[model samples]
Target: MVDKPVPDATRRSEKSRRAIHDAALALVAEVGYPKTTVEAIAARAGVGKQTIYRWWPSKADVLLEAFLDLGAQTARELGQEPYVIPDTGDLAVDLKAVLRATVDELLDPRFEAPARALAAEGLVNEPLGREFVAKLLEPQLRLYVDRLRSAQDAGDVRPDVDPRIALELFVSPLAQRWLQHTGPISYEYTDTLVDYALHGLAPR
Candidate 1:
């Protein structure tokens, strides 16, 4: 039996999809999400308007895919898996290491611009905000939840604590600092967050 050749149309579609993602990210970074349009992305991507519409329902969809791809690429570059948080028995050490890497990612030029644009838009655009939180943010956050639960089981964390809320004590502060430029991001800062969260600020 002969091997079947890959379909030319499928190959073409994949190329177009990558181009669209690149174009959408570029446009969002350059002009912000509210100003980026399907037509503009198609033009920049060297594809037709119909091609974008055929693949995605809206510009938000295209941007979401682009952001997700960027995150995966960052994960690969960091020698980390995109979907899992490390659980190395010492919860503070593991959390600090991951967060230090995240600080590097947030400061990366390629990731920062589009991410800032999308995040700013998400602040005011309720539907897009919710979509981003649900699809891109929450899934990543669940990894922390899993790690915390394991820590609790190991007696490394307080059993009565809610993992979801407990994770936020460190995670949300870092997120706010990065997102709003409220403070400096450093290895020390993140390490401190881990220490503060785990040991409690009330002298325990």
Candidate 2:
């Protein structure tokens, strides 16, 4: 079969995939998502228009993968698994530890720029917003679900509580702070979140 014509296109496609992801993230960060386009990404990435279309159906898809890749890279650098929350027996300690690390990740420039861009877009783009929540955000949230379930089983958390919703008490507060400039995030803040969530805000 003439050595399959060297498969040069496959190698070129892989390079173009990386380039497109980089370009999409940069464009979103620089111009915001409303003004970003496949044409702009293609030009910035130094690839043909068809190259991006070949892989991702839309800019939202490209951005979603870019954000996921950034998270994975950061996790690898920190020597932690990207999609699992640790259960160290002490529920408060474990939750606080993970949330503290998340505070660091959210504050990092590399993660912040692109994430803010995408989040701003998602606020107005209904379909894209739901997709981001479903695919990228929800999967990560499920990690907390798993951790909380373990805590419930261990009698650290109330078994009657729904782990999914329970996890959100702490998770959503931190997310809101980071997303909306609502407040400062720190180990102390996250620690407080865990404490309040576990013991209840009332006079427990």
| TM-score top scorer | 1
lDDT of each: 0.89, 0.87
lDDT of 1 by residue, 50-76 (tens): 988987899989988988888888888
Angstrom error of the Cα, residue 59, model 2: value is 1.1
Task: Pick out the ten consecutive residues of candidate 2 with the lowest summed lDDT.
Answer: 1-10
Clashing pairs in 2: none
As for candidate 1, its clashing pairs are: none
